[model samples]
Target: MRIERLWIPEKPSVGKDIVQALIRTKRAKVLNAKSAATDGYFSLDTGDVVCPLFGHMLTMLPPAAYLTKEQNAGNYFEFLPLIPQPFKFEPKPDVDAKGKAHPPKRFNLIGELSKRAGQIVNACDIDREGQLIFDEMFLYWGLDPAGNRFLRAKITSKAETDLDRSVTALEKNGAEHWVRQRMAANARQVMDWLLGMNGSMAYQQLTGIKTMSVGRVQSPVLAMVVLRDLAIQTFKPQTYFVPVVTLADGTALRWEKRKDAAGTAGFDAAGRLIDKSLASGMVGAIKAGARGTVAVASTKVERESPPLPFSMGRLQATASKQHGLSVEQVTKAAQNLYEKHKAITYVGTDCEYLPSAMHADAGAVVAQLASVFPGKCAKADPGRKSRAFNDEKVDEHFAIIPTGLVPALSDAEYAERAVYETVVVRYLAQFYPAYEYEKTSLVVMYGPDEFRASARRDLVLGWRELEKPESTETEEAPANGPSRPLPKLEVGQQLAATGVSLETGQTKPPSRYDEASLMEDMISAYKFAKTERDRELLQETQGIGTSRTRGPILQNLLKRGFLLSTKKGKRHEITSTPFGKETIGRLPPWLTDVATTAKWELMLSAIALGEAEMQSVIESQIQYVKTVIERARMQVSPRQSAANEKGAGAAKKAA
Candidate 1:
């Protein structure tokens, strides 16, 4: 009898491991899913030749025209982007150490196996790139699309249980319309490739630099930092005085100046307090033991819901803040936890909610963890519906969480353990009760000025047993400083103003972007948009780069010397280099704007969803590039010349 096969996309040995894991969990019978490594290469006998494709079996290549242009351009490779495109793909190389081109063994093996197998079931990772990786090979290997079936494996973790579950729940006959995903990935890859190369060329041509590395996502991020730095550089510090009064109860409050006070006919646009004299006069009056009655004081109990579970972007930011790890570092640790430790589920997801189908299993995992941790989930009700398990929120992948496989990490790195613990705690805290607290605000009358005092009192430990708001998180009222529990105060209570003061301070420029803040900014870039539609598009798309791509993009930027990194205590501060600033300055707004890039990403998504055609998006993208270059050439040439002339004049003057 002919045996059936369930081929997957792991390396040869790794494929064997998957089969073994399946067998261990009794998800697959040991006799049927035996390992076969007789030829020094491994495969699984899962009633068939279940094998691994390693990674990508074929490599995507630029068009022949672009290749010719790139080869001939030599040192001036930047101009190669100016060429038109008809992207090409060729089989990736695979050979032993004898300097022999043995051809791709996996590709050939797949071809050989496809002939015997009735259906080609794609058991690769459930992602666009993963779809492309396997589909490209199958198509190239001459497998018919009708016969080729896709079974997307949603492997949350590499644990035996997860793989068993993922393989068991594998949707037959490509239920997700996964081929469209391949189309989307192809469009994205080609689009980014074209944009980066072309954008870099335009920058090099405009700035007279031989080389630059600008991209759809990268240039905008660089612009964000550089523009911020420019804002800091050009900002003229304005001296302002805030009149503050302290009560006899040691309650300090700032005097409210709704409109400008007397001696100021009009307010200064830059400075809040145009008349320091008025503030001085008020301070003198208060120092003479000014007595005032409480104006409006209020207290209310507030319930702060537990934070949404960790999306990849959120996880990256949290890890960067909590452990002082770089985004790339956090991403690597996360990948390891999912792939190696089998502790956490799909780490690349942007979603904070689990799929409705997985809620039962996820709740079971939580219950198991609760038993292990003891008392942490005391208030947690697994049966209770929560925000963590929302069907609408789950997209291609679910949130990162423990897969009920408690990782038996023997000697993991401190940072790795820290990241894993972070994910675990985040998941644990999701089940706990909402953190309850009481907030009190007191407003007192000191002449015409109203002084405000606010305090936060903890009402319940709640979910805070597992998670607490970061100390570094921005407060609603930073000027008031930290919060403390307040004593009882009535609205009509009389209070003595012990002293008054005028605090002199200069306005601060926006803080520099650290990995944490930068990640947040990148994720929330849509919030900065001028319009609602732009914001909506961005929110849906999750801003520029995807969860898997941002870390690598940042790494590429740092590697290419476009940005400089400096360590400030625990945080790594990212600053734009002179070249970076120049690149952003030289690019047109359409190219440098994050919203514009986000639109392109969003368009690709629309294509994937059948809302838009792929060819139309690509054509529009090509036209957009041409337009950007045409417009930028005009703006950049004059500026570059002016800068050069200015530099020459300065040299002459020095001489």
Candidate 2:
């Protein structure tokens, strides 16, 4: 006899809703139902009923009676009734000469399932969520975990054709790493639930605020933004002067100004220049000279390595600057390309290359990409740098790349496709060779003034040929010769200068943060922070949020009015708002500090890698949370209570 197999579709949220609906509609009917016992079977007698074996069992058992004695003792185990208890397994007994054992043969669900065990295969999506879904189903069915064979399918698109191919591939080999990743992913979810539920409830009760929520990452990130705003608000600008001189030939030269003849801007208590005034006399003396001899003039070759492939954040920032698309818009397009078109790999990866196993099929990607990236595609080079092949970096999935699927997209989709294609082409270029260039700088001096000019002659365009021209200024110059060659000169050589004039300008504060600069700041927050320890840890962990979460957090900050965009022509300037300042000022010192979050991230990373204990990290985090709750309670209590009272009065009057 063949083993009987049972499969359940797992959709947790939807399943819970359905169960609740069923209970509400059939509670009375189920209570009134009768059970009939036959020779070898038990039957539920209902006029109208449709359910699987497990559902029928659930209907038969009283909710309260289903719980164990310990679970029924308190409300803490409210969820216990929902826990699934699957049918048991039993082996077949040998038939007697009379053709029956003492219990007799029975046709039942459990007996059927036991016989069918060998034929079972768990077919789940190859991801963490899918693994969890299958795991839950297996546990509920009382199936032997070790005896089960698992098969995973990758569904990158909603189209039937794509799904068919995924199913076929899954039938060939199971995704084992995806199963392990699912375990880690589920662990993270449980940790978040525990922290968020308990922490939010506790903090809300302490602070008297309704619906106040906290999470493993969100609260800490919010605190970081508030802290940054505070720093900006308290920032004071200092005065500094730069002196510009006009030569006899009308050329202007700016000299590095100092406070005194000893080139000191300001001196310490040990008799060094400590103020700008000391450089004032030197500026005056230089101004009187009216001319100077060219002291030095030299230039050398410089090369810039190609940038790594686009992570989601990099792609968004690039699109925002180049195409005027918002980060949200670009992210949506990228997600579509990954999920709907199946044209790209995962979007949030920081790595630029696929794993070694993927290298054998690199030619397929290049061949499929031949049309869009004509000159960019080439056979994979075996001698490529180790940075492009390390397995340790290829977590979950490799970097975003072409999926070897020729894209058929609409006009709007084509625009997004171009942006994605640019990233892929650049990534492929890394396996090629470095671009070379000759840079020249001409330093000229007339009277006491000196001026410098620079020009670059590209020896080879290399990967830069793929980049689109943004403006006439960036148009490729004729590669034939140097546009502005300087005459050879000795140290004392004098030269005539043109365009001489005195230019007056006030000292400006640091520029407001733009998207790219903000990204860089977030990437290197510790280095920019006031303390060395803060910088070290931040650098170690790489920044506040992961690639997956940074763009969303920034968007939230902007939407909440903490950060505002100032548009000047095509450029955007991000400045902190007045409300942002107030919020920062009201936040507790520890909560708002970026260092706090940075340290937390460092500790969390260490824990994930088994270098630190999870319990120790949790203990430190709990203490931090307690401190935050106390500070927020003291600071927000009066204001929040007054607001709540006003709301209650309004509600009462309305009623």
Candidate 3:
């Protein structure tokens, strides 16, 4: 029963894979193979056991667990804020059909194993959440998390080579890096718990909204939706006009203002004239046989580098735009490709760069991809290093790439195929040359007015040829102009106007935040920051939530009826419900301001980086929660205030 070393991966399947890899590398042998799945452990010949955690084995204890006896018997508002000194934790429980709660089945097994093992290795995922998982588990099982017996196996993937190397190089559990991660995760969890518990209760007490729930991230996300919906509801369009002259070749050139007349004709910032008379006069004169002389301003070659590989957020946004897939759908498909098919590397990573050492392996992977995508992979020079291969840019995991596993997927797997093919194409795109094009900028003079036109001509379809979707034969042209090459013209060639007309258009309102755009905003939240420091912090933290948690946060809003989503063609148009609007209006500014949340997020990240103390951050949040709750309690409705006074009197009598 005395196991020398215990290995704990994040999932059961991962544990099995790690065990098999150890055996394949002749580093470990099965002592009891049957016990692997039946129980949660696989005893090894090297006197180590491989057992896995089911995501998180422990969760923060609810605030009710720390309520005083008097507070339980009386008005709960009296216990305005419940701050756990050390933050007690309990095993995340499971409920049966009969509604009886019990610890997870493997909880006892892991707990017993922890007690008997000489050394326990935290072989979880290599992320903050993973470290928190092991930290909470050890604390719940009454073991010292910082003890010398505890070690760490920083595993990023389930591949045999990665697992072998990770297991071979076990790190000290109490190392500063690992400890700081634990501290950061702990602070984040504690902050969320405090906010949800205290803020929700305070909101309920003040507004009597029984269905309301507040969170650190979700409230601000809800505020964003509500504000956008209001903006769209209240938006008023202003009409503008422009004189467009049509040439014999059907190229319509819009009138451009000269430097002296830039702001003379009631022109807007975008140079659209609000004066209908001026536009009409220009059109009338141009249509009356006005001859224009061509003034070729510039003609030059322009090269656009290929897009870098996909991060999860980038992949989600692209999939939503190109394939009409939601972020949730793309996430699921990507996860399937990573976990089920083993076709790609880790899917939960935010990093989009690979280690420089991975170039040789990537070349081999590209060679394998040629079998499946011959045309796309034909010119893929994987040996040529792209900007994505910098080692310094890599985070906990590298950008997702094919593991060289050509999966034989069925046609029914639409999402999977979409995700896999996109990833494959994007990865190969970096290996090809930049897309080169000839851009011609022209200015035509008609009497006293000037018109501008531009055209793009393809010079070399380097990566663009390979980047096109399989379903499309031709590339989609840009919106403003045609993709055709412009006709050759001299600087002073005279051209007769075929026709001229005034085009009237109205300004459009901002689009609604669908799941894709919302996710994009969440990643680029620095734009909404109130202060420059918050903006910088948001940029570093990649907006509000991590890629792994953003999808769920959005889904939770839908589940809670805070935001209503409607299917408009292929995309979902998201709008805030009236109740959601009311909830946000009643919530404090700090809870709804993204800049405030971004500051806290940065502090949490700093804790993980060992730049800030965890206890100080947690202490600050505790005081913040207390003040927020007190403010809410004071801002209660008159009726609710009377009811609260009545309840307090009743409680005092009982006490």
User: Pick by TM-score: which candidate is best?
Assistant: 3
Q: What do the candidate models score in CA lDDT, each in turn?
A: 0.70, 0.49, 0.80
lDDT of 3 by residue, 543-624 (tens): 7777688889988999888888777777867889888899998887777887678778889888988899998998899898
lDDT tens per residue, model 2, 1-655: 3322222222222222222333444331332224311222111122211112221111122333455454333222123113224312232344689987544233244345444444333333334444455454444556533343444444433233443454345432234454444444444444444445544544444444434555565555554545555566666644444444444533334543222334433533223333556346535555455445776656667765555666665666666666555566667777777655657765655445557766665665667677776666743342554245557665544566667775687785755666676556656765555567777654555432334544567786655665542344354342223554444456677654333333333333345566655664555558546677666657665565556666787777778776676665544556666655554444445545555555665665564444666556655655655554455445545666576456545655555
Clashes of each: 1, 21, 0
Q: Which parts of model 2 are misplaced by more than 4 Å?
A: 1-216, 219-240, 244-253, 256-280, 287-298, 356-363, 373-392, 440-456, 468-502, 507-529, 533-537, 540-542, 551-583, 607-613, 630-655
Score candidate 3 by lDDT.
0.80
- TM-score of each candidate? 0.83, 0.60, 0.88
RMSD of each: 6.2, 14.0, 4.1
On a 0 to 100 scale, what is the lDDT of residue 434 in model 1? 83
Error of 2 at 479 (Å): 22
lDDT of 1 by residue, 309-364 (tens): 89899999998888888888899888878777677877767678887776576567
Q: Which candidate, 1 or 2, has the higher TM-score?
A: 1
